[model samples]
Target chain A: MDVIQIVVIGLIATVLIVVVKTQRPELALLLSVAAGIILFLLVLGKIGSIIDIVRDLADRAGIGSIYLGTILKIIGIAYIAEFGAQICRDAGEGAVATKIEFASKILIMVLAVPIVVAVLDALLKLVP
Target chain B: MEAIRSLVQNLIVIIILAMLLEMFLPAGEMRKYVKMVMGLLIIVAVVQAVGELVRWDYRDEIPPLTEKNNEAELSGIMAAASRITGNQEQKALEQYKSGLSKQVRALVHLHKETPVLEVDVKVQSGRNEPDYGQLKEIILFVAGETSSGKESEGAVKEGVEPVTVQIGSTIETDEHIENRDSPAGAAEADLISMVANFYNLSTEQVKIIYR
Candidate 1:
C-alpha cells in the first residue's frame, strides 16, 4: 500500500477506536482486531517474500524441504501466538496472553523434534 | 455479468464469515459483533459500487487532446483575450507569448514541467451568471502563492477582463505514462495563470473552473 493509503486506513481505525471507546468498549476491541487484521493483510506480500528467501536458503544448504517446512511452520506458530497474545492483552486478558505464549513455545518444540532426531541420526552414522 | 457473479460470491463469503464469528462470540456479544461485521461489509460494498461507477464514467469522459482540439481551444481563448484587451490579432499574439511565459512559471512553481496539451476559457457575460471564473482564479492564486513563495500582490493585475479557463489534461494511452489527476493545488493555479496570460490580466483576476 502507498503511504497515503496506509495513513488513511490508520486514521479511520483511530477514529473508530476512539468512537467505540466512548460509546462501546467491546466494539472498540473488535475495531482494533479488524484494524490489526487489515494491517496484516497489507504487509502479507512482504511476509511472502521473506518466506520465499528462507525456503531458497534452506534448499541451498541441503537441509531438505521437509526440514524447511517444519521450521516455517514453527515460525508461523510463533507469529500467530504472538498476535493472539497481543490481542488478548489489548482486551485486558494478561493471563490469556501468558498461556498463549506458553502454548506456542511448546508447539515449536514439538515441531523441532523431527529435525533434532535427524541430526542425531546423522551424527551416530558418522561415528559408525 | 462476471462482476456481478463475483460480487454475489463476495457477499456470500462475508455472510458466512459473519455467521461463523457470531457462533464463536459469546451470546451477549454476538449481536454487537454481527452488527460491526455487517457495517464493514456494507462499507466494502459501497466502495466497490462507487469504484465501478467512477471507472465507467472515466472511460467515457477522458479524451485525448488532439492538435486540432488544442488549436481550437487556444484560438478561442485568444479571441476572448483580444476582445477583452481591445488588441488586434498581432497584439493578442504578443500577449499570448508573454502570458505563456507566466504560465510556465506558475506551472514550475507547482513543481510541474509537462508540456501543456490544451487550454479552454469560459467567460460569464451577465451579472446573473455565477462567478465560477472568480472562484477558479482565487483557487489558483492561493495555490500558486503558497507553492512559489510569491506574494499575491502582482499575481493578478487589475482592470483585466475576467475570463474562465478550463485546462483539459493530456490523455495518456501509453503504459509508461502513469496518468493521475493533477496535484492537490497545482492544476487550479495553472489554469488561472493560463487565462490571466491569455487575457492580459493578472493571475489573480483569471479564474479556473474545477469540478
Candidate 2:
C-alpha cells in the first residue's frame, strides 16, 4: 500500500483502539492485531520481488543457491516470528510471545541444518 | 542512480511505516520493541540497496572528484596559512616594539655623549604598531649612520650614567635631549631620523614634542 493510505488506516485504527480499549480491551487488542497483519501482508509482495531480484543476481554471480536460500529463509522466519510476537504482546499475552520467540529460534537453526551439514562434509573431504 | 533512487524510496516507505507503528501501537514495552525492530529493518534495507550499487560497479559510472579533492585540500591549507599569519603578526608587533625601545636608548646615549641617569617609557594611546618589515627599514636607516664622533667613547670612559626613555612615553631629563622637538635641519635631522626610525615611521609620521 502507498504511504498515505497506510498512514490513514493506522490513524483510524489507533483512534478506534483507544476508544474501545477502556470498555472492551479484548476487542481493541484484536483490532490492533488485525491492523498489524494487514500491514505486513501489504509489504509482503514487495519483499517477494526483492527476494527474486537477489536470487537472480546471486545466480548470475555463480554463487551456490542453497546458502542463499537458507539465509533468506532465516530472515523470513525472523520477520514473521517478530510480527507474531508483537501481535501476541499487544494482546497482553507476553508469555505466549516469549514461547513464539523460542520456537522461531529453533526453527531458524533447523533451516540452517543443511548448510551446516554441507560445510562439514566439505571439510571432511579436504582432510589429507 | 536507480539503486540510489530506490533506496531513498524504500527509506521513505520505512519511515512512514515507522510512524504508523508508533502511532497505532499501544504505549508500553511492546511498542518500544516494534519501533526498534522497524528502525533496524529500515537500516538493513538502506544497506542492501547500497550493496546492490557496489555490486553493479555503479561508482565507476560516476565521474572522479579530483577537482573537489583539491578544493577541500586547498581549504584546509588556507586555514593553516591564516593561523600562521595571525601568530606572525603578533610576534612582529612585539619584536618591533622591543627593538624600537632599544634603538631609542642607544641613539640617546650616543647623542649626549654620556650614559643616561634614568628614563621612563610609557605607551599612550598606542596600538596597531608598524610590522617587522617597517622595523627593518627603520633599523637600516640608523645602522648606516655613525654615532658621529670619537667623543662618545671618551664620555663612556668618564663613567656616564646609562641612557633610558619610555619607548612610547617620557624619559628623565638627563637621559634624553628631549632633542626630538628640534626643527628639521642638519643637526635635528639626525634626531628626527632617530624618532622616525624608532617608530619605524617616516619623519611625517613622527610627532616630536619638547618638554
Per DockQ, the best of the predicted structures is 2
Q: Give residue B35's lDDT in candidate 1 (0 to 100).
A: 38
Per-residue lDDT of B20-95 in model 1, one digit per residue for the tens?
3334322321234233433443344334443454455454666534657888999999999878765464455446
DockQ of 2: 0.03
- Ten-residue stretch with the least lDDT total in model 2 chain B: B149-158
Pairs with backbone N, CA or C atoms under 3 Å apart (clashes), candidate 2: B115-B161, B116-B161, B116-B162, B116-B163, B120-B166, B121-B166
Cα lDDT tens digits, model 1, A42-61, are 87887677667655543433
Lowest summed lDDT window (length 10), candidate 1 chain B: B172-181
DockQ of each: 0.01, 0.03
How far out, in Å, is residue A10 in model 1? 2.8
Q: Provide the global lDDT of candidate 2 against the true structure.
A: 0.55
- Candidates' chain A TM-scores: 0.84, 0.84
The lDDT per prediction is 0.53, 0.55
CAPRI quality of model 2: incorrect
What local lDDT does model 1 show for residue A40? 76
Q: Tell me each candidate's i-RMS in Å.
A: 20.2, 10.9
